[model samples]
Target: MLFGAESNLDLALALYDLGGVQFGDFDLGPTAGRSPIYLNPRVLISDPAVLRRIALLIHHEIQADQARRRPRLASFAAVAGVPMGGLHLATAYALVSDTPLLYVRPDSQQPSIEGRIIPGQTVLVIDDLMTGGTSLLRTAKALEESGLVVRDFIVLIDREQGGTERLHEHGYHVMPILRLRTMLTYYHECGLLDTARYRTVMDYLERTSPRRWSGSP
Candidate 1:
């Protein structure tokens, strides 16, 4: 158990049991999906060890980031987590990074006056997974409207579904603790998992993702 979480291998299994991450495809309805698995780590908030480990890992990464000083990690004015799913991550950031945390709401409150951008000093929106950039884009737009420039985003896993592409389109970068493909291969190599489930999930995500949308603007 890494910090009391189910063994990291087991954690992936538990995540798999919880229906994998659905990494990218959510709209295709089985017609033309690319991924066959999905992991909603947000669902794992209930497990104390998992939650604690996530927080600790964030701490470790931050320290490591500081150690590898090309630009030298700078203290964030604040940590902004994308709402709902990102809330827990924001709290962990607040505690570990000691940075104040705020989350952005997906919808604008009133257009001209209210949306208010979850008020923070400097934000790093957080989320558990990134499949389509839909949610992240929305969060960025809201924060931007509120005068906060969302520079970097942090996520537990990147389905690699174009979330990074979408964010780039909107001017934000993503940092994920685990990339789906790499993690899956790791588990498979360790014998923690076989390929059957991997194919199911990956295929499903690829097919149904926003990439299929035409004239979507």
Candidate 2:
């Protein structure tokens, strides 16, 4: 689903202004590899205004999806934030929407989930970004184990990697507010990103994208 162009641009600018979007040769751990661009929405927490805007954007998107009768996202009874980064967004969303919030705490011998875990309750998984989807999948597995149902996953930004496809293969749906490619294009068009930097990030995304290139590099 596409958000309004103005809203998208505003969000892109806000992310860049907040230092959430960075251009560099940063390491993305072993699984995700290196990239020319990196997005860290965790910075949103440092700015309450931006964080609230983000939460509202998510809330609106979910409402729009429900209005369109997208059952997977429309039928969720609660929201679950994928730990560490996602918890903050989930908390803000829960506060705004009055929806029950859930999270898994796998820090103990008997790992368990927080919030009211009614069996068979549908949960919408929330996260800041998507790379290979390992964290989201793990969170979903934990939720399912606790008798909660998970079908819809939402993120602020999608890295345009294999994350969405990977989750789809596992029968889960992903909804990203902004895609890295789209943001890059916007930035370049608006002069926020130079031509060279734009091309570099675009090329990097294509080469590392599982959809374009087979197997991990």
Candidate 3:
């Protein structure tokens, strides 16, 4: 794996220092009212060095997954990035992996097959973060309608907010590089997160999680 346990722990701490993960009251969405911890991957785009590192990490992980035959990553013929947030990440991955890149439209605004994807191509869909898998499902549907096969989905962070389960139910294998619960635990252990903030964020995640899913050990 590109980011082993120790390396991932360091990455989580680095992201915290980068102001990507913040503690405070913030809006999650219409359904999820308010949140104590907010995660934003867009900040990484501002720093080319960090963004390239992230892209390389993702590339290495994908290569490792392919080597291990984990969820059959080797079958992927192209990388499809869910629009708005995932485009840059996918671009970087393509640059590193020398894979074809496809940008899935956010909605049905464009022709289904207009992007860089070819019909009958197997694609691995990627996104920045997954909260409920709603956007990803939409993107996958569009890809399928365009005659592309999508079986695997990837995200930079999984909030453990039921998105993975939801995607699995739809027959899509989901891979998350970092999980919110794990990151929070690491932050707390390293003293990067205070006790009160840690408890509050943990409570909020537990309360808001659709299935109250805890990440893997």
Residues 98-167 of candidate 3: C-alpha lDDT, one tens digit per residue: 9888876555566354457578889988998888899889889888988899999989889887888889
Give me the candidate number with maximum TM-score. 2
Model 1: per-residue lDDT, tens digit, 97-185? 67766665446464232222444445667787777767777776766777776777778777776677777776677777777776777
* Cα lDDT computed for each candidate against the true fold: 0.64, 0.86, 0.81
How many Å off is the CA of 53 in candidate 1?
1.0
lDDT assessment of candidate 1: 0.64
TM-score, one value per model? 0.72, 0.92, 0.89
Error of 2 at 134 (Å): 0.5
RMSD of each candidate relative to the true structure: 5.7, 2.8, 2.9
Ranking by lDDT: 2, 3, 1
Better of 1 and 3 by TM-score: 3
Cα lDDT over the full model 2 = 0.86
Q: Top lDDT: which candidate number? A: 2
Q: Please report the TM-score between candidate 2 and the true structure.
A: 0.92
Clashing residue pairs, backbone N/CA/C < 3 A, model 2: none
Q: Write the per-residue lDDT of candidate 2 for residues 176-200, one digit (tens) a residue.
A: 8889898999899988999999999
Q: How many residue pairs clash in each candidate?
A: 29, 0, 0
